[model samples]
Target: MAGTDHSVAPIARGPSIVLVEPQLGENIGMVARAMANFGLADLRLVNPRDGWPSDKARAAASRADHVIDAVRLFDTVEAAVADLTYVLATTARPRDSFKPVRGPDEAGQELRSRIEAGQAGGILFGRERFGLSNEEVGLADEIVTFPVDPAFASLNIAQAVLLMSYEWMKSGRGENSRPRFVAPEVAPASKDDLHRLFHHLEDTLDEVGYFYPPEKREVMVANLRTMLTKAGFAEPEVRTLRGVLKSIDRALGEHRS
Candidate 1:
């Protein structure tokens, strides 16, 4: 945890951060610094390797006094998250836990959603090198994994904290989303628009004998509708598709004639 004095800007509310068997006081301080960067204040230490109340940690923390001052220690991962309703384990590899897996972004959203619904949540950061043990991961309700290169999946403890904390903050501020390049003022796809597109497509396909044998027609038609309905084409897109279908039909008819 090389000290980054980018200034500490803690938030009012966020999930607890539990460090399980963290190896270094410096890394712990950096994790605290990262947490403070995204407004996360709750810091829980689970059996830190070098013991607690280290002046080295405080020195590394720089300006994250709020996070360091209120650090809580626990002997085990279960005890760390016992008071919380939801717990997420940050792991780079698949673990024994068959719990729901999500990316940092999705995990952040889930955490925020659960918190909003009156559920307490926390994210567990494993040891610096080997990461969370399978038994430790099993305790979490969901697993948050990063999509890093398989050849090198490990990340620093502070780096992991920064990524999740950033996502969590973005979700709360409604900024944790990709940019939408929609055409100006174009309303997104509606159910009715999609239904109309499906109907038109089915009618066109019927004329084209796409359903084949009569016995298989109902099932075939339903399947076709299912495929198109899932697309959820926007109103403009639906109109364009209908036009394309009519053009194709006209071309087929002319060819037949």
Candidate 2:
């Protein structure tokens, strides 16, 4: 296993590769091949155009049958990442949105930290045609934009996956801390824990007037939830955060009075 998930012993923490609204089966297959090449195993599809489990994709995947076979399907991005604690959205072009952006190396370090804190962390890849929507990008805890020549920056889906996967795998093999074969002690956060923390944080944010438009509240909430969950905060850490929020609220109230 390239990445280890202490949550599920003998189970690796190869970040889930989510292809949101992918258009072509061949791309999906190729992405799978890339993942397999880098020791990633989980493949998730959200509203793919060409359809999943397609023989065309399998054929393209070549020796990556394990990735193709384990492909999980979902109708929406939210559903696809419901179980993930930390998520990074990959994009060649910046969205100009006000969210934390990281490169593959920093994102990989963050992912490893989150997993060590015992949370399920993963990355999201958008379609070849449109990349990720602002809405989709917002769902990520951290946005990843690869650095390339200013003239030519676009990367094929498989290339993006390979880059991120490679970084994560490299980080996992800390030379001084643990041997390559020896498993690390970290365990990723569970789906249920992430869901609860997201709700708690959203409620706190709502109370603080962070989300303004009532109409867009749901989407905003969903995006925030996605980002935090993907960061994969540990249960104790989440509890501490909630406490911090409560303290801040109390201080604000006191000042207003």
Can you list the residue pairs that collide in candidate 1? 11-39
Local accuracy of candidate 1 as per-residue lDDT tens digits, 1-257:
57655564545778899899888889988998888878899999988889988778888887787889999998877567756756788999876434678999889988897686566789998888788876566556678999899998879999999999999988787444545673344443443454556667777887888878878976675555444533434467878888998898899889989
Where model 2 places Cα greater than 4 Å from the true spot, the runs are: 1-11, 177-257
Model 2: worst 10 consecutive residues (lDDT sum) = 2-11
lDDT of 2 by residue, 1-257 (tens): 35533344223556888999888888888898888767788889999997767988999887577789889999988788878867788988867566788988989888887777666777899889779887777667779888889798888898899898888778777553544575554444554555556667777777778898888897787667655745646567766777887787788789889
How does each model score on lDDT? 0.77, 0.77
RMSD of 1: 16.4
Backbone clashes in model 2? 12
